[model samples]
Target: MSALATVHVVVPARNEERLIGRCLDALATSRALLLAERPTLAVRVTVVLDGCVDGTAAVVRRAPGVDAVHVTELSAGGARAAGVARARDLEPDLDRGRTWVACTDADSVVPAEWLVGQVLAAEQGAVCRVGAVHPELGPAERLLHLGWLARHSHAEGHPHVYGANLGFSLAAYEHVGGFAPLACGEDVDLVQRIRAAGLAVVSTGDDPVRTSARRSSRVRGGFADYLTALAVDLARAT
Candidate 1:
């Protein structure tokens, strides 16, 4: 088996029992995408249950086609690192050249054509495919999504990579030292590092990934609150 055939989607989850099931369904959908794109590609899902005192593990276990690993540690940074390591270890043949590691959050749902679209972007010469992630929307979730879209729209000039749905060639990830050990904004940090290394980053805006807004809502101060939060984050980063 070639390294590229061992593509794995690593999801770092923390107290996401309510959303994990939907995320898993999305993973299954993504696998179908892989099969459609390359019938022989072997796709795997790795869910790292981090600091989950809830039934997150059970949810993953019940979900079809998922490899769940429970890690009591609360650090998402560490959990993701461990998950990626486990994925690579499972398929020893997956060295830097042909393998790829995709990262997504357990609270997010992937598009049905997510994997196929990503693979196509990579094969089309994108070193790191920065995919867009939209907050799940509805009357109940409308405010949150609108807030997210508004704040993120300013980032239009640069391809925004959501920690919930991003991918990188194993070689590219290793070259850039993987995700930064930050409490948050790891996705943006990783993308910046990739570009700093002279790698071309492209986004799949045409096929966005949908992620639950449940977690975001917990901290969101309604629409106004979200805008304030975004301002603070951007200001701090700047």
Candidate 2:
């Protein structure tokens, strides 16, 4: 039996018109699966459009069962924090301890069991749940994918943290002062703070989300940059 009453999902987008649609579609499926499994739980998906100057907003508008917030901060951390605040505004009396805050990137496609897994982990007394991510690479990027897999681990206690697949109790999030306003590495920073505060953090390889492996990233030092760096290293070794 789960003790959680509500779950809020936050996605931050910046000129991701080409991929945000797929991301939301996957999220809709996950949301449906979660609701079907736990009929009493409340689920909300909010997409934060940060400094978008393209068709991204239109794509978000076409998606059903999702709320959108506009911000010009151009910071992933700021967008995420704004999304959470919007969720809180919608549920004025939300119980922080009993509420779960899940985060994912606008360019990632989450598995149908993503939300269910996080909810289950939260119910089991996990203050934070960090899942895994598998990059969606084209045939041309096979080497990059291979290199990534060779350097990454997919185990129960894997040492990986991604905003594309992270969830935490609202109580724990607030206690850590929430996410900082940074351009990148916000997910890692939040997790570090949570651990430093002595919260029960759960790292699982199950329900890995699929994110784009594009070289051009919206923010510096993001997954795209990491993948590019990996490719460079591979090139140097070859």
- lDDT of every model, 2 decimals: 0.73, 0.92
Candidate 2 is scored at a TM of 0.97
On residues 1-238, what C-alpha lDDT tens digit does candidate 2 reach at each position? 2499999999998889999999999999999999999999999999999889999999999999899988995578888899889878998998998999999998899999999999999988999999999999888888888899999887998889999999999999999999999889989999999999999999999999999888897678888899999999998887
Stretches of candidate 1 off by over 4 Å are 1-3, 140-147, 154-157, 215-238
lDDT of 1 by residue, 1-238 (tens): 1335567889988888888899888889878868876887778889988878889888988888788777776455677777888777777766666677788887778878888876776677776877777766677545555557766752434456677778888888888898665666667787899999998777657557776644344222332354457545655665
The candidate that achieves the highest TM-score relative to the unseen native structure: 2
Candidate 1: TM-score?
0.83
